[model samples]
Target: MAKIMLVDDAAFMRMMLKKALTESGYTDFVEAQDGAEAVKKYGEENPDLVIMDITMPNMDGLQALKKIRESDPDAKVVMCTAMGQEAMVVEAIKSGAKDFVVKPFNGERIVQTVSSILGK
Candidate 1:
């Protein structure tokens, strides 16, 4: 069982990702409402994967990814981005995100991304 962290400022977004991940047979999720919390939780929980929203308060996903990468070079992060955030997406990739999923993503796509990243 993989431990995953879900980071999003919106409670609804976190809930949606949680529901999708649960349905895809993933358990042990840790949720964060912002990038600051995401970094803290990453240290505490050390989740196998992090699914983080790009636009978050306190710190954006790119910053959090950078911080996490600095601490753990092998961190597996899957950034969540909305439409028209191409530059940020490129930055995320440069910052070391393993992959990304666009907003309005389907459950199947999320599952596929996670499974592929985790080699499940």
Candidate 2:
């Protein structure tokens, strides 16, 4: 199983994502509460992929995404954004986000996206 990192300010959101991924048979996970933590953990954890929220205190996802990509060009990142955040999504893609998932997302969609990106 791939080691996945879930990055979000909300503990509930991280729990939900972990639950969804766990149900799909993904057992390995690393969690970060904000983009800053995410960036720091990325270096330490080197997760196979990162599912990150677009907005967070300390450092936003877009900025963190850039920093991670700057350090590791092959970093695999998928941005999670609330609806009406298409502009940030665009910026994320430009900044090397592998994909974007809208909030209120279903487990299936996220699972599929992760599978596809990880080439599982």
Candidate 3:
């Protein structure tokens, strides 16, 4: 049971992800609505993994990812992005994200990716 931090501006998206994570046996989750909050929460929560959206109010995911990576080089992050954000996605990877999930999330894929990252 790994703790996860979910960063997204959309409440519904967070809810959907929370449900999927719950169903997959991932119970601990910390929620942040924007990148600045994500960075703050990451420091306080120190979750096992992070699921962050690329587009967000305040700092945005890439910036948050950079901050987190600077704080902890081994931080495991997975971006939640919309379609056609390949450039941003590549930048995220370069900035130290472990992986990413596309928008209009697929429950099965989400579960699988998280599981794979957690080595479950």
Candidate 4:
């Protein structure tokens, strides 16, 4: 079981993601509401993977990505994005995100993305 960090500004999004992850046989995880919290939780929790939203308050995903990468060069981060954020996706990839998933939440694809990243 891979430990994951789910980071999104919306509580609903976090809940949905947690459900999907649980259904996919991922039992361990931590949650963060925004990039700042993500950075803090990541340092403490050291999850195996992170699913992050690009647009958030108190620091966006890209900045958090950079910070996490700086702290852990091998960090595995998958970005969650809304439509019309192609530029942000590209930037995230450049910043060391391993993959991306678009939302309003596709459960199967999210599971697949996580599985593929973890090579499961």
Clashing pairs in 2: none
List TM-score per model, in order.
0.98, 0.98, 0.98, 0.97
Write one digit per residue (lDDT tens) for candidate 3, span 1-120: 899998999999999999998998889999999999999999999999999999998999999999999999999999999999999999999999999889988998999989999999
Clash pairs, model 1 backbone: none
lDDT of 3: 0.94
TM-score, model 2 to reference: 0.98
Which 10-residue window of candidate 2 scores lowest in summed lDDT? 13-22
- Name the candidate that leads on TM-score: 2
Which candidate leads in lDDT?
A: 2
Candidate 4 lDDT, 3-103, residue by residue in tens: 99999999999999999889989989899999999999999999999999999999999999999999999999999999889999999999999999988
What range of 10 consecutive residues in model 3 has the weakest lDDT sum?
A: 20-29
C-alpha positional error of residue 46 in candidate 4 after TM-score superposition, expressed in Å: 0.6
lDDT by residue for model 2 over 1-120, one digit each (tens)? 899999999999999999998999999999999889999999999999999998999999999999999989999999999999999999999999999999988999999999999998
Each prediction's Cα lDDT score? 0.94, 0.95, 0.94, 0.95
Off by over 4 Å in 4: none
Residue 106 error for model 2, in Å?
Answer: 0.6
Task: Give each prediction's root-mean-square deviation over alpha carbons.
Answer: 0.6, 0.5, 0.6, 0.7
lDDT of 2: 0.95
Candidate 1 residue lDDT tens string, 22-90: 998997999999999999999999999999999988999999999999999999999999999999999
